[model samples]
Target: MDYRFSEQGGVTHVTLTGQLNFAANEDFQAIVERIAKIRGGKVVFDLATLTHIDSVGLGLLYIAHEELAAVGSSLSLLHPRDTVLRMLQLTEASETFDIIS
Candidate 1:
């Protein structure tokens, strides 16, 4: 996966593209770690271009969420595709995560 990070309205936005699987491990973790290090910013994950995701990807997402929460920041995952969306829903994580189109 490829991600671009930007800032807007006091929120940090990350746009992720490509497949969110094991191949994306390193970069994904780097991005999440970078975001986690930043304090007091609302982190918005724009997953509109992500076509697929796996359990490892979800685990990274959970880590990101936990990191952000621990740092007193907030994280939001947005624009998930049907499969990824379903996975989140099936896991009941959609209730805790703010998913938007």
Candidate 2:
């Protein structure tokens, strides 16, 4: 997986593309650390270009959510592709996140 970080209207946006799986763990952890510095801030994951995700990817999202919440920050998943969205929903992880279409 690959990601780009940008800022708009006081929100930090991370645009993800390619595939998200165990291979992305290291990179995703770096992202989490970066966002964790923003206390009480809003961070959005723009997943519109992300083509695929696996259980490991979902677990990473969950970990990110918890880390951000603990730091008083918010995390949102935006425009997830159909396949990725289904994975989230089927796993019942959607309810734990703020997802935006």
Candidate 3:
């Protein structure tokens, strides 16, 4: 997957596109690590353009959440595609994150 990072209203916004799968694991982790370094406020992942996600991608998301929380920040998943949304629901991920549309 490819992502664009920006800052607005003191919040970090990450817009992800393409497939978020194992192929992107290394890049995804690197990006998340960088994002985790931010001091505080919200980190929003805009998933509207994301087409697919696999188990590894989902795990990375959870890791990103925990890492950000540990730094006194937060992670929010936004505009997830219908299929991805279903995956999140099926996995009961809503309880672990704040998802916004």
Across residues 1-101, which tens digit of lDDT does each residue of candidate 2 receive? 89999999999999999999999999999999998999999999999999999999999999999999999999999999999999988998768998898
Question: Which is the leading candidate under TM-score?
Answer: 2
Q: For residues 12-74, what per-residue lDDT tens digits would candidate 1 score against the true structure?
A: 999999888889989988997898888877999998888888888888888888889998889
> Where is model 3 poorest over a 10-residue stretch in terms of lDDT?
32-41
lDDT over C-alpha atoms for residue 48 of model 2:
99
- Of 2 and 3, which scores higher on lDDT? 2
Q: Write the number of the candidate with greater TM-score, choosing between 2 and 3.
A: 2
Best by lDDT: 2
TM-score of each: 0.92, 0.97, 0.96
Per-residue lDDT tens digits for candidate 3, residues 48-83, read 999998898899899899889999999999999998
Give the better candidate number (1 or 3) by lDDT: 3
State which candidate, 1 or 2, has the greater TM-score: 2
C-alpha displacement of 73 in model 2, angstroms? 0.4
Q: What is the lDDT of residue 14 in candidate 1?
A: 97
- Candidate 1's C-alpha lDDT? 0.87
